[model samples]
Target: MSFLDATIVNVALRTLAADLRTSLDAIQWVVTAYLLAVAAVIPISGWAARRFGARRTFVAAVVLFTVASALCALAQSSGQLIAFRALQGIGGGLIMPVGQIILARAAGPARLPRVMAVVGVPVVLAPVFGPFAGGVLLDWAQWQWIFLINLPVGAAAALASLRLLSRDEPQASAPLDLPGLVSVCVSMVALTYGLGEMGRDPSATAVLALVAGVSLLGVFVAHSLRAAHPLFDIRLYRDQVFRAASLSSFLLSMGMYAGMVLMPLFFQSVHDTDDLTTAALLVPSSAGAAIATQLSGRATERFGGGRTVFYGALLGVAGGVPFVLIGANTPYPVIATAMLISGAGAGLSVMPAMTTAFRALSPDQIGHAAPQLNMVQRLGGSIATAVLVAVLQNGMDSHEPTQAGTMSAFTVTFGWVLGAAVLAAWTALVLARAQRREPPRVDAPAPAPQSRA
Candidate 1:
């Protein structure tokens, strides 16, 4: 639901502008507002769980997301939709991390691989399908249904979480790190705002916010060092395996999410495709991801997370090559093949890296680690989007308005995506080496069966 919301509304942005009698600049806030809200709220998920118990927090998040979605559907103007989207983002942001806290604590190290596979579904595929989903709703129904569709799913998820999730004892008496919360929230909100703006329009205010965000983040880190019961423990990175996994996840996400943007643009601009057809072309990629998610856990268990991630990253790099060379006349089958390979690469790598990180930590540590992991991944996606979109937009602006010129712009942007994928592969190798250097974690999984020589 969260990831879907992240990308789904994009297909409707132009329609939204027309419907609401708003400018594209104003309508873009529908996305920026949600992203800013999500960024602002994510750091608090672990703290929220610790304060209210994971079950309660998760349910409340679902309810809030659901309620906000309904409000979004009912929105009478652009401002109302944007505000409601922000409200929805607060809930969308909390859902994943806190749910991870609950699941990781419950699953323990041994079951985490398969458990994470389950969690990876929406995380991996939602963005892939968002446009298709949105296109369908708009074609068949109303733009409002995009938000309203979440109503049933969100309600079901909330009820399920309430019934199925185990309730941990809440640390009701834990003192809030008020300063840490404010600094982190401000930093994230500012940084996301900057990145979001940079993607659509580069401006002086965005640059200032970016600098302010970085400065405040430094201040937050310093504060966390000294504050007792800080909002989240930055010290977890002291564990080499955890640190490697964190870096790998961040880098891999930079490639994966940014790549999603490129192909859709490629099909639309170069191939002269409609929204649904472009989205339909992504089905192969989505299928590949689904298949990889199921297989990644077993592969991780047999080969180790780092090794599995390396192989997955390689696949992603291979998948990316087609795009870097894509043209207006690029074959559809070739595009579909690349999509599958890239999607599989993403599925194969992302979870194993995260699973590897959690496996290296004790159950008690997951609560401390999960939110930060989610935050870094979120930041990675934001950074990637900003970089890629800005590049593509600038290229388009500078180039002649021709099919070949548009193709050239997309291909150049995709070269950056490929570079990020290569970087992701390098980090996975680093993660593999780091994993080897570490002593056996207290939460290590069962040994792989010995191969016959």
Candidate 2:
């Protein structure tokens, strides 16, 4: 529900602008505010869980998210909606990471592969399905239904969580790091919103925001080193396995998520299909992801994470090759095949990489690590979007809308996606080597010889 809400409202942007009697720029805040709020709140998830038990925190988050969703549905103006969306984001941001913490601690490192596969189903499927579902809803229902749909799902999740989740003891707490929280929140919100703006309109305000965000990020890092109980422990990166997993995630996410933007444009510009038709054409990719998720965990357990990721990245490259050389006249079947292969590769790689990260951390560290991974993945997607948008815009410098020109623009960006996949493969190999170096040797007993000595 949280993941779906993040992307679903995008398809409704135009409709929102029309119905609310506002410009696209104004209605965009409805989405932007939610993302910024999520970014701001992510660093606090660990603290929240440690302060309150996981079960209580999870229930509260769901209740807050569900209540905000209901409020969003009832919003009378753009301002009201954006405000409520920010409220919703505060709740939405913690749900996934907190849930990961609970499951990771319960499942233990041995079962992390299976756990991640289960956790991954909705995470992988939601973004792929969000826009399509939204398009369908808009075709047949009112705009409010998009937000309203979350109410039942969130409520059910909350109730089940209350009954089913174990009441684990909360960790010993220190005073919240107010300065660290402020610095991190500011940096995240500014950077995320600025990059998002850069994708749409590169303005002075966006540049300033980026600069401020980077500067504050430096401050936060410095402060974290000195603080006893910082929002997150930066030293986690000292673990080679965690570092490698994070790098792989960042690169693969850039490659995979670009498709969310690129494929839709490909269908609209080159094939001249309607929204519904384009969405239908993309179903194979989502299906491939679903299939891969079911099989990837066992593959990771058998072959190890490095080999699994390496193979997945190879599949990604093969899938992306078609896009690099694509022409305006390319058949839909061919494009569909490329998307399917790409999505399958993504689904296969993501779970193993995440599980690998968790395996590198202690149970106590899982809460912090989960949010950090999520934040990095979100940042990766934002960076990929900005980069691709710039690439596409540069390729279309002549302002031509011809199919050939559009195809050229997409080709350039898709080439980068291919390059990112190759890098992911290399990183996976590195991660494998690091994992090998990490295990300590178990010595055999010296038998009766020691007694004689």
Candidate 3:
């Protein structure tokens, strides 16, 4: 339900604007507000979990999310819906990350890869199922049902969590790093909102917001350097593996989301498929990804990060070829095959990247790094979506009414996606070399607990 909510509203945005009697630009805030809230609050998840305990935090987040969903259903205006969505995001941001942290903590090093693979399946599937589900609900039921559906699932998850979750007492004397937290939150919120606004209108206000956001982020970097207990310790960047992993993650998401936003349009307009058919055709991508995740996780454990990433990137680029070459009459089987291959590549790449990032950090740092990586991935997705949409819109506007022109535009946009894939591949090569250079560590007892800073 949480994952579904992330992208489900996207396809419904136009309908929502008309129903709410709002302009397209104003209605965008509904999506932006939720994303901004999620990005802003994600940084504090580990701190909250450690301070209150994971089970307690998880349960509270579920309750909060459920309540927020109800509020969304009851919203009478765009502003109200946006506000409720933001409220929902606050809870939603914590759910997956906290669950990841718990799994990481419980699984230990030897079995961590397998656990991550299992967790990754739902993560990938969420976006795939979200749009399809939303389209179905919107076709048959009122738009409000989108939010209403979460109630039952959230309630069940909450109750299951109470039974399945282990209770741990809160940590003593953990520093909150309020200054660092405030600075980062301000920076992320400003940046996210500014970018979102720019997607609708690159006006003076939007430009100023973008500038302010960048400046705030600069301040955050400086604050982290000086603060005694920073929200995310800057020193972690010194780990070559972590740096490679995080950057690869950001770039991979950039490519993946850019393709996602573009492909649906291609399917609908170029192939003349209906919305449901387009959605259904895209399922192979997620299905392939889900299947490959487990295999990639195991491969990463045995073969190491470099080889896994290199092979995955190769597949990603190969998979992208069909989209680049797509014409007006491209076959559905070909499209589905390309999507599956792309998804397989994603599955192969992402788990290794995540595991590599987390493994490079200390257990205490895992909390911080997990959220930071999540933030980067979200930011990358947002930026990629905005840029690609702009390109597509421009292409559609300028091109003459011909099949060739339309295909040309798609080709040009996909060229950018291809560049992203190559970049990921190059980064994978660098990571491989770095991994080769690192000294091997003997399996040893786990380190003692360190308080959050």
Candidate 4:
């Protein structure tokens, strides 16, 4: 739900502006607000699970998100909608990480690869499908349906979480580190919003926010290393496998999401396709990712995550090759085929890296570890989108408006995407080498505990 929401509303932004009688600039904030809220709140998700217990935190998050969705659907003004989206983001942020923490503890290391693969389905598929889903909603119904659509899914999830999720004791009732929390939250919000601004408009404000964010992040890191109870454990990065997986997750997210942005734009700007048509063009990619996800777990189990991720990253790099040469007359079938390969690469790479990160850590380490991994992935996508969008925009602005010239811009953007994928592959190769030395520790099976969530 969190991931889906991240991209779904994009298709509705224009409609939202028309309906609410607001400028596109204002309506865009509806997206930015949710994104910033998600990023800002993520740093505290570990502490949330620790304080409130994972099950409670997860359920409450689902409920909050669900309620916020209803409010967004009913919102009468742009300000109200943006506020509701931000409210919704708080829930979106917590639901995934806290749920992962619960599942990680339940699965244990021996079974983590397979179990977390199940968890990773949304990570890869959401971006691919989000625009498609939004286009469907708009074609069939009003814009409100986009927000209203979350009602059933969120309700079912909350109810199921209540009944199926096992309850666990809170790790600590200690007070949240006010200093660390503020520093990280402010840093994330500033950093993400700044990144968003960089793509939308490269103003001095964006530069200032980025500088402030980076500076504060440095402060938070220094504080975390010294504080008695840091918001998240910086020490987790010391583990070589965990470190490598985290880096792989970050890089893969950058390429994968930026490509998602590029795809719709390529089809629309270059091919003059409409929303529905572009959505349809993305189907093969979605299908490939779906098929690959089913196999990723077993692949991780058989080959280890580093090998699986490295191989997957290679597939992604192969997939993007065709796009570099895309022209006005480039065949649709070829583009579709390339999308499939890249989607499969994303499916094969993303979940395994996340699972691998979790697999490297002990159960007790999950609370601190999950948020950091999640943060890096989110921030990576945000930063990459900013950078790639800037590159594509500049390339287009400088080129002639002809089809050939526009295609040139796309090719340059795709080169950057390929570079990111190659970098991810390198990181995964490092992980593969490291695992050979200190192999992923598989814990002995432990008895399941009986409890009500």
Candidate 5:
């Protein structure tokens, strides 16, 4: 439901702007606010679970998310809606990570891949369905219905959580890293706000926000080094697999999102397709991705993360070629095939990378791992969008205002995406090498030696 909500409003952007009497730039905050809040709160999920118990926290988050949805539906102004969405984000951000933690804990290392495969179904489907559902709803109903739909689902999930969730006994609590938290929050907010404002005005406050965000992040790194128990233990980087996995995940998102942002434009501008047709054309990719996610998880378990990621990256690179070569006269079948392959590649890589990274950590380390991973992925997408947008705009400028020029721009931007895919593939290779070299640590004590003669 949360993931659905993330994209649901996208289709309703025009309606929202008209209703709120806001410009496109101002209205974008509706999405930006949610993303920023999600990024900010994810880092605290483990702490919240420890402080309030996972069951309690999970239920509370669901309820909060549901109520915030109601508030969003009722919002009369852009500001109110944005604020409500931010609240929704706070709850939504915690849901998946915490659920993954619980599942990981329950399934243990041996069963984790299976559990991840099961859990990944909705993660892939939600985004695919979100915009389509939102468009349908907007055409027939009001934008408020977009949020209202979550009520029943949230209620059911909350009830199920109460019954299904196992309580973790309270362990010794670490003091909250208040300074680190504040610094990181400032950094993320500034960075997101800045990037979101790109292509608008070079002299705008958004650029200043970006600068401030980077400065705050610098402060955060410095603070983390000194803190007794930082919000995120920087030491996790020392684990080569974890480092590689994290970097690969980020790069994967960058490439995936870059391609995603360009695809619709490719269809609309190059193929001269209408909105509905473009949407219809795009559906297969997401559907393929959702289906592949489960399969990929199983493959990861059987074949190992390295091989799964390597194959996925290879497919991703292969998929990019079609898009780069696609033209104004390209056939639907060709576009569909490209999208399906790319989506499947993303499915193959994402879950395995996430599961493998988390698997590297001890049970206790998950609190930190979940949020940090989420943060990296979000940041990667943000950066990718910024860079891709610039690339597209630059390409657009270099040609005449025609279908061919638009196609040219898209092709150029996709080239960058292909580069990112190659980088992701290389990162997977690095992980494979590192995994082969590192011996697994045995946490339990070795059996006591028999009494020696």
Candidate 6:
């Protein structure tokens, strides 16, 4: 639900603008605000889960998300919707990290690879379908259904969590680390918002925000190193395995999601497909990811994460090669094949890196670890998107505005995408080398426990 909502509303941006009688600029915030809110709250999610217990936190987040969705559906103006969306983002921010913590604890370190692979289905599926779903809904129903659709899903998840999720004995709750929390929030919000601004305008304020954010992040790291019970345990990064996993994860996201942004535009602009058709064409990528995900668990188990991801990353780059010289006249089958290969590589690489990272941490650190990786992933996507967009624009500027020019822009942009894949492969090699030094430890199977509440 969280992932779906994030991208679904994007297709509805124009519909939302028309229905709400707002400008495109104003309506864009509907997406940006939600992202900012999510980033802002993520650092604190670990503390919240530890303080309240993962199950309770999960339930509350679902309730908050459901209620916020309804509020967004009924919002009378753009302001109301943006405000509701921010609340919704907070709910989403909590859901992702807290839910990961619950799953991590339940699966334990040994089964984490298989479990994360299962958990990844929806994450990979949602964005693939989100725009398609929204486009379909707008074709048949009112614009508000976009938000309203979440109500039932959220309610169902909340009930299931209540019944199925295990209860953890609450740790001795400490007072909220005000300084650390504030610094992290400021750092994340500033950085995320600044990156968003860089995408749109690259204004002076955004530059200032970026500088402030980077400076604050340094302060937060220093403070976290010294503070007892820091919101995020910075010490986790000291471990070579965890650091490698995090680096690989960040680079993969940077490459994968930037390519995600570029592909839809390629279909719509170059192929001249409608939104629905564009979405349809992209299905092959998601399908490939899903199929690869099913195989990744056993593959990782047999081959180890580093080797698995390195091979996958290589395949991903091979898949992207078709696009570098691709033209408007390129056939759909060929493009789809490339996407399939890239998606398979993505599936092979991401989950194992994540699994490896989780195995390196204790259960108590899972909450922090999940959000930490999420933050990196989100920032990576943002940076990649910005950089690629600039590359496309620069390529276009140097040529006439013709079909050939569009191909030139994308072809050049794809080079950067290829570079990103190469970088991901290098990081995967790093992860693999680290694993060789200390192999991923798989635990003996343990008995499952029943829900406490």
Residue ranges of candidate 5 with Cα displaced over 4 Å: 14-28, 76-79, 163-172, 196-207, 259-278, 362-364, 385-409, 439-453
Q: For model 4, what is the error of residue 117's alpha carbon versus the real structure, in angstroms, after optimal superposition?
A: 1.1
lDDT of 2 by residue, 220-318 (tens): 999988887777778889999889988988887777667765666567666777556666777888988898888888997887776777778778888
Q: Candidates' lDDT values, in order?
A: 0.78, 0.75, 0.73, 0.80, 0.73, 0.75
The parts of candidate 4 lying over 4 Å away from their true place are: 13-32, 74-82, 163-172, 195-203, 394-406, 444-453
- Model 2 clashing residue pairs (backbone): none
User: Which 10-residue window in model 2 sums to the lowest lDDT?
Assistant: 444-453
- What local lDDT does model 2 show for residue 436? 76
After superposition on all C-alphas, the RMSD of every candidate to the true structure, in Å, is: 5.3, 7.0, 3.3, 3.8, 5.9, 4.2
lDDT of 4 by residue, 285-359 (tens): 898899888899999889987899988989988998887876789789998999999999999999888777766
Identify the candidate with maximal TM-score: 1
lDDT of 3 by residue, 212-250 (tens): 888877888898888777777767778887788778888
lDDT of 4: 0.80
**Range of the 10 consecutive residues with the lowest summed lDDT in candidate 1:** 444-453
TM-scores for all candidates? Answer: 0.89, 0.85, 0.88, 0.88, 0.85, 0.85
Clashing pairs in 1: none
Where in model 6 is the C-alpha error above 4 Å?
10-32, 74-83, 163-171, 195-203, 362-367, 385-409, 443-453
Lowest summed-lDDT stretch of 10 residues in model 5? Answer: 444-453
Candidate 5 residue lDDT tens string, 1-453? 776786667556656878999754566567667766777777777777777777787788899999999999999999999999999999987786667556655454566666767776665555456666765676567889989988999999999998988877644568778888899888877776676556544556977988899899889888888877888877778898789889988898777656554565566557765445555667977866876786886797677776787788877888878877877788889878888888888888876777777767665555566678787776676566555665566677778979888788788878888888889999988876776676333231111101000
Q: Is candidate 1 or 3 superior in lDDT? A: 1
